[model samples]
Target: MSELERRYHRLLRAYPAEYRRARGAEIVGTYLDLAGPERRWPSPADAADLLRGGLRQRLRAAGAADLIPGVRLAAVLAFFTATALAAVWSVLELHPPRAEWGVPNAGPFVSLGIGVWAAWLLAAVAHAVAPGRWTRRAVALALLSTVAVVPVAALAGLPRPPLFVLLPQVGLGLVALGLPDRLPASVRAAPLIAIAATGLASVNVLPRNDLFLSYYSWTASQILPGAAVVLLLVVLLLGAGLALRADHRGGWALLVLLTPVGLLFLRPLGGAVDGNMRGAPNPGWPVLAATAVVVCLAGPALLPLTIALRKRRRGPGPVASGDRCPTCGRTAERAP
Candidate 1:
């Protein structure tokens, strides 16, 4: 082999063994044909292209090449959002914003609850960085710890756990349940680091407030009707995007992302709206409608449609031979 060919072969090592076996020679031949006689090294563009192609093939082999980018985005959003909310909630519970930063007045149960959430967040980071059976096992254990701590704290007569504290843990558990079993490690690490950085900054720099109570208060009006409508619309659009790109499974995964918002919808809009507003009692119709539409599109409607479309595109089964039926694998009579 020429020097150029030898260098190309080394670069091709980025691809999986099976893929290299199947198409390596064809790819090498194409590259050699494109190169000049004096070429002895890969151009930067060629090296980059080979690396990109190799990563793509690896994702395909893992059965998540299509879903990794979307899932990674969703995971980062979930992690940072959860971490910020948890930190704010813990900070507020420990020291009221208007009051002095007193000693850590939160009881042992509160501390334990906070630790459980922290552990859950770390587990999510671990899974995102090194996804596999063992990382998944760690996530399961972390989820169980969060679940166990919540009930124990409640039973011990600690204050009712706030929504921010509970929502992220629940969402992580859902992600653990729904995420694909295998994913490329290259796709995992970047998002984990981004989430960790944002989480640290949010906890350290952001000021705490009664933000949780403001959102969850039964009598206090927190969000305006127009804002609620916009939020719901954004959720619906995100769900639709996931459905189109990753199909039904991805659509369903958005449910975890929207769970906290969905829970908020259960609260009466009348209490959260102005009394003199036009359709004050009924202005929330849009919110409810949007929620129902999103649920249908992301849940039942998308799954069946995807399945039907795939089946149609796949066509029908092959014809059965005399000894057996292809559809049911049963014995068939011989032709006369």
Candidate 2:
């Protein structure tokens, strides 16, 4: 094989073993036919295209043909969730019950300077109206801003939210990066309106209390933050249910992507219930961190099993005419 052919083969390694075995020669030949005689290596464009194609094919082979689309859809949902969480969390800093508990009374300039939540909301707006590349840039900036919170808070002597809380927001931002460059205008408008309505409802229904205190205390004390978390969970479940009805892959995508966020929220919520019942304090960050780690580890292991089980439940697709039967190895008969 020529140098170009060798390099192309290396790139094709991104594909599954079975796929390469069946079509590797044909793929390499096609590239070779397009290359000039003097070509010593695959062109940059060709290399990228091959890698992209390989990844897509691999996902299809794994029964996730809709993974990318589902991820894009999930990204939008995640972005909205992350933004709302950030908004609620941001308020905690502005109104700490004690002088030392948070940035207590820190003016909008200092408290909202970093504006992690606003960054995500702006990204959503960009995604709604901007070009694809610009939308990606906006999302990337929002993600970087979220990561910057820790160091920024440390340096400024500010008390940020717990690590468990921030970690999942980061995860959501990362997933939101999968959002398509250009979504329909309606898609963009709906999330913003939903967020607005959430804000209004929160303002009207919940009394004026220190959000931070409410979030950390027992169930009865945590009414406001708890309600917010529950509402967000309900929105996510509704999205997943609607997606599942339309396309199974979309529902699964939402579930998988939101798993970390759900784990984070559930721990605190569970701790609150237990704390209330036992007259104990809510679990600390350490316990929550442990739960996040375990979920991260178990997620990969459980996904394939879940997919396999789903496939088993679905059984096999209808055999087309001339397709060999799994049991008898006889071609299927045509419909009358």
Top TM-score model: 2
* Per-residue lDDT of candidate 1, residues 273-332 (tens digit): 433355465335455445445533454355345445554664554322343221122345
**Model 1 misplacement above 4 A:** 1-105, 108-112, 163-168, 180-187, 190-192, 200-205, 208-336
Clashing pairs in 1: none
Backbone clash numbers for all candidates listed: 0, 0
Reference-based TM-score of each model: 0.44, 0.72
Give stretches of model 2 more than 4 Å off: 33-39, 43-45, 89-105, 109-114, 205-246, 269-279, 307-336
Window of ten residues with lowest summed lDDT in model 2: 322-331
Compared with the true structure, what per-residue lDDT tens digits does model 2 show for residues 1-336? 677888899999998787798789999999999999999989999999888888666555545555555566666677666666655554444444545655343343334323776776687577667847777788788778778877887787755544555667766777677666666788777656756665666565544554433434342234333533654565467667755544444455645564645554646654665576675666655555666676667654566676566556655543234432222223356566
| CA RMSD of all predictions | 16.3, 6.5
Model 1, 258: alpha-carbon shift in Å?
5.2
